[model samples]
Target: METLCNNFPSKLTFGHDAKRTLLVGAFALGTYQGVKLTGNFLAGVWKHLLRPGYDLKKRYASDSSECWAVVTGAAMGIGKEYAKQLGRRGFNILAIDKDESEMEKTQAELSRLGIKVKTIIWDFGKISNAESYEAFEKELKNATNGLDIGILVNNAAEFQQESLDMISVDRLFRASSVNSLTPALLARYFIPKMLARYNNGLKSAIINVGTNAAEIQNPRYKFAVYGASKAYLHILSSGMREVWGDKIDIMTAIPRQTKTPMCPVDYCFTATPRAHVNAILSQLGHESETYGTMTHDIEYYMRFGMFGGFVIDNMIQWLNEGESKKLISAYERRMS
Candidate 1:
């Protein structure tokens, strides 16, 4: 290879890497030459591999969106799911999230379910006072212009892992605005519209994404402020259900640790945004999972109550052990 390259025009090999590239190109002109140029060939290939912008095209689904059923946090995790799930049940979806790229991916997934979609990328932080509601109405007026929605899912919430005592007051307010205030504002704004429409024999529903972390006091997940805020969410949902008087369907869901970015990977990622959307749709179709289980309340209690505590206690122990599988098994048997 060196002998043959020595014979090539010297000008073609002016620079360091340029010389090597020219030699390799000459060698590729024949199999005998390529074999003689093993070191150069491999070196050239390796250099190209190391360089960026050599990315392969990813095979993808046809990207599409549904212009109805607006869901917040509609990017990579659970919120990304509303479009797909709702679309399957014959509702168009308006998937909203902070990440436009991921939202497009989710929109494509839902579009496969044959639903039209629209997307909005906006920040929705909550406030404690009545002004929160006004802000939500304004946001709605901005993002959704004359769009009809059979369902609204407020699935977006800000999350982080700083010690509650250490985070500043401004940080605290920011979280309160994201987790508690935004949902409340959205509920306040959307429900009245839903109620007026419901009188015309249309049934509209609202779902507030609640949490299991708020149910316990723990050291590992030091979101004390966030936990306290979630308590307000739980109470607010119950109050809304009571006060709304069945005119608007409201449901609160406490999904276990999902495999979302905000959550640690140690926990199971079952309750995706897609699953939540499906649960809502199933409820709408009048299945046993719908709205309240006034009919199945007795059986649900008998079945889930006993094991729920046991499962929770053991899970807490496992996650606290740094999500170690070995520690979890030991903890489970010990609990048994």
Candidate 2:
């Protein structure tokens, strides 16, 4: 057997037929993988983009008479849009935010839709601390009184791009409070009510607004406690879905560039607040996790699907670093 192996011909001595056959097999394997990837990509496109998505009215059985929707960070950006859309969908709104004036405006706008609008002015950024937590809980309890909450949108967040030494311990803690702790507390407070409502034949949903960066480990976003906090929320939502079973709908929407005050206004693949929130609402019960926009869905498959996390992380890091530099310049101009 050893002698036969040693006597095997080298590639140079192979017959034309053998070489052609080997080449054909290699091409066939490559073609198979290419076809598989293409099929997966197309299927994802059909599900996320082309699909009509979940029908909110049908999900709630067309009865939103006494249902209330709670939206954190409801003053501006995607959060504000969530409040408005839900209000339009016939759900009364409880808008929670740090900005009293902005929330007042939101309340007025939502009120015009003939839906009750309750504004709760409190700083979620301080929610992790005992003193602030107690105060927030008190406010939440009062705000939720006599209300049957059918949906909870955890859209509040804090974001900073500072290196370890540059970011204060206080800042880190606040980011954690806003992005992670507040969502957990809010869900804990409202989920039981949602479940009770569900048992009464009312459907409920929880949407944890997440970030694409949370799914990828990019060192450039190392200073982003925002991503880390969102990652915690992402995993928490996944577990909550399992724990709640069919009692309530749970989703974690990981969006890419959304044109918000916190993010660059003209970034590539950026979606308007209305567009972003629409995508999120459409995909709510249909998917436990989604990119939240067609552009984000395409970007996700192209980046994560084709190159995996490492290259995707580097791409994100490159974008983040550029945005950070722009932020620094803008800050310097403001200071000067």
Candidate 3:
């Protein structure tokens, strides 16, 4: 009884000290995380909101009108806006797409901007074939002869919104070609030209359009294959930047939901094509990879933060459910 009484106070003090230490450590950890998030948020505001973009006209010497910007999928959506914006900045535009009528419209708009505009109606899906790709390369060279190609925008992509097993092999192949192979091959073709331009005291840039879905660490539910293809694109962009970033301005513009034909709904976070393109262009020469908009930057941080996986998973599930309902309703209406 004497021994127990003698040791009780010391043992009690040790337990109390341990609990207090744990509490202090947890508080310190929470404070560090909070500070990190706050710093990141403030930096994003400065980058996307306050900071001025690099001057394209000054950088490319717009007075000459010899610099050209080639844009794929330039008939509509984000690609169309990129063509318009680059043309407005005095870069001649080479617009490529499968839709002849749409491309004609885009060409007309670009011509009205007083910049040279050329449209090529080629099926991106066809470029999967070796001979077709070689032919396309020859066409590109012929079309841009006597022009300084300053920018190449790889913006064409096939969006697949189905489960992996449900998607057709042809569809997946086409997506891989458009989202993965096309950008890689186009970069290979353009890097030499851009480097040559660099040797001649000119600057060039390549912008590869990617998807935010590819950045998620978890497997995307309905768009796994699509995400995987875009992930390959993201990696390719990074590698190219590592190699040629100093010589040429190379960047990957990753956008989330946007108001385009592929995603028609105007959600709260969805940016218009013009807004998204403007944000992306503004970030050029500053960042190797960008989310393309302030809204998207926030969304990216939130989705990847601690406790973000649970929320994002639920949100994706809800969106998938909503999509299924829409498809079912359309089917029923057709049957009726």
Candidate 4:
């Protein structure tokens, strides 16, 4: 560094003496043989070691770097988009679907991105015979070596055109199960393990895909039965956000009628599922988070993507010390 400091004037004497003093200060008494390093060299080495990509930093160590993201309904539509984007970001993907063929197709897609892919054929619409937690725990074992799930996206859903009066009790339950109940079960199934991992201090995220119908209150797009089911999902998600601590991020995105299978032919053109995928990928795991919007359509206009994050974050911080009611009240108040 003295040689590197050639441009300094006859402060050369000061530099030389300072280097000698630091060199002497390095060892308890004196220099080790003739090879002595100045304190400046030690500070430089410390800074370099802490810098990004340094081997000593361990930023990319297997323990820190591997991410396992599991997405439901990932065979196509928004879920498929989530899987591809996450895989492209180097996350190993575990995708699930009732359709074995589509699961296989996503496996191929993830593979092409050089991401290790695992396909689990399970129907979230039906509760597992085993408890939901055990079922997911079992699936996690089949997917990865341990319990470090980086993210979970609940996206599997079905839509119908039938009116509430025309829909049967069983049929309503079926649609409800696909859109709401399964997500709750998957949350119950995944949250304990997620919390445990987070308590042990892991970085993880949970994304619940909600619908704009939940925001509109008794709207008529997908179906009345389905809309009411999604309304239940909104309350349930807010409750989960309450329990998942700050270290673990939990968010529900409400995208409107989209060019996706979740909506029937009538609603596709108004919403673009792919564009919403970009909006969501931009929001996830980004320390800058967004929150409290009943609809993703409104989220598009938020400048503080990081704002409202604390709405949930504060709840997790004090462990049941916060409420989504405040957020809900504010959003609803704005409507009038």
Candidate 5:
């Protein structure tokens, strides 16, 4: 009795008047908020306009001989870039990834910088259930054994674009686990260590890379789980930072589109991984959350500030609906 159409339901609807009124209200709110936020945006620009400044250099100019940084998904893209930049900053790196070959490449590259490079080869996707998570926890403990980790970048993520009904339950589980659970667990594991360093007057930082997908309204194209998981990260970072702000510098790096293997499109706004990582690194200790790229920061303000939340929300809904239809049709054609 199951049909392809049944798996891909029709898009939701709002009558014409309702939608019109909503759009008008959203645009109005956006304009007002945009005007109000312009001041704060300008202030941020003034503060961070200069990069790799004397103060920034001095802050991170520690001997870093005993310091260590742990980067998840360190095999490629943003994670790899983070590892490379951190290594160059004089911190020994613990690079974690399932791709042994890519990790080897990463290790070889970082080794040239003369920093100690240790690799942990493990699949974050295998962690689909409680038992598996426990095993993963143990495995992680063994991998990080005898290491003093000062920085943790919870960057590993699972992104599968599929409709809700069409997606297999197992796929959903994997996406949720890697996107949210892994980061949450890793944060829990490393935060105490960061705090412990506080007594010694040493500072530690935890960076969580978040996505604008969290702000999108009614995410379609099978992005429901991904959006929700990223939203969880931002919320988690905010709350945790409130409680541990004095002890450890917890930051949420909200990145927009960047040129990574994971992203399907390479739009003009899409920042190169190096550019994005460099922007983020330069802002360390200056802000708790950042767009990490100048273009993204402007995009964020325009989308949410000028266009307003309502406009952004409605645009996402419309776009998702269109994309979902195209994807569903393509999938059905393939199946047929």
Candidate 6:
């Protein structure tokens, strides 16, 4: 009985020690995560709020008229907004798109900004056709001749919201061409020129517009091709930054849903094209990769970080399913 009493007190003491150890471990982990999250939050605040964007005018020569800002997919939506904003900022604009009439309209709008506006009507979807690409190259060279191009915005992309089986081979090829090949080739063609200008003491920048869908860790249901292609662009931009970031400012702008013809939804979180472009422009040289707007950043963390993978995955599936229903309904109505 005496030995049993002594052993019971020892067991109780050991249990107490184990509980204490667990509590300490949990506290330490919580504190570490808290610190990490706090640091990230403050860094974001600094990048988005405190830091001012680089003076883009300084990128030009003494004669700003010689400098040009090249923007692809510039006929409408975010690309058009980028062209307008860049033109307003004193840079002559070279708007490239497949739609001639839309390009003409964009040119008219930009011309009112009093900056020189030029258009190149070349379809990026024809990237697989060697002869077509060569023709586009010639046209681009001719258009940019005698002009000091300072900025390149690779904003052209083909969005396909279909499952793998539903996606047509032609569309797959076109998406690969437009979403991946065009940006890669454009950067390859322009980087040397940009480097030459940079060597001559001119600043240069490249903004490769990507999508938030690329960053999601979960399976992107109908966005297999689109997401992967944009992911390629994002990584390409990162690689370019590694190689040429010192001389030229290279950034990837990843925006969420914005109110555009491509994505016509006007949810509370959806950004306007002008506002989205403004947010992206404000972060140039400040961030290598950005969500483009504060709302998107918040949404990203909430969906991916706080809500976890299961929630986000289901949410995405639901949204994509809803979009699929709308598309099917529209097609049926057209047929009827």
lDDT of 2 by residue, 165-236 (tens): 787798788878888999999998888888878878888899999887687532424445667778899999
- lDDT per model vs. reference: 0.59, 0.79, 0.82, 0.61, 0.76, 0.82
Candidate 4's error at 234, in angstroms?
A: 1.2
How do the residues 168-232 of candidate 1 rate in per-residue lDDT, one tens digit apiece? 68768877877888777778777877777677666666777766556553323555666777667
lDDT of 6 by residue, 123-204 (tens): 8998897787888899999999988888999999877766678878988898889999999999999999989988877778
| Candidate RMSDs in order | 24.5, 4.4, 4.7, 19.9, 10.5, 4.7
lDDT of 3 by residue, 105-168 (tens): 8788878878789878887777777888999889888887887788999999877766688777
Candidate 4: give its CA RMSD in angstroms. Answer: 19.9
Ranking by lDDT: 6, 3, 2, 5, 4, 1
Off by over 4 Å in 5: 1-41, 51-65, 216-222, 307-336
1 versus 2: better TM-score goes to: 2
lDDT tens per residue, model 5, 214-267: 766323346677788778898999998999987877889977778665664544
Would you estimate the TM-scores of all the predictions?
0.62, 0.85, 0.88, 0.62, 0.78, 0.88
- Residue 27 shift from truth in candidate 2, angstroms: 3.5
**Which pairs of residues have clashing backbones in candidate 3?**
none
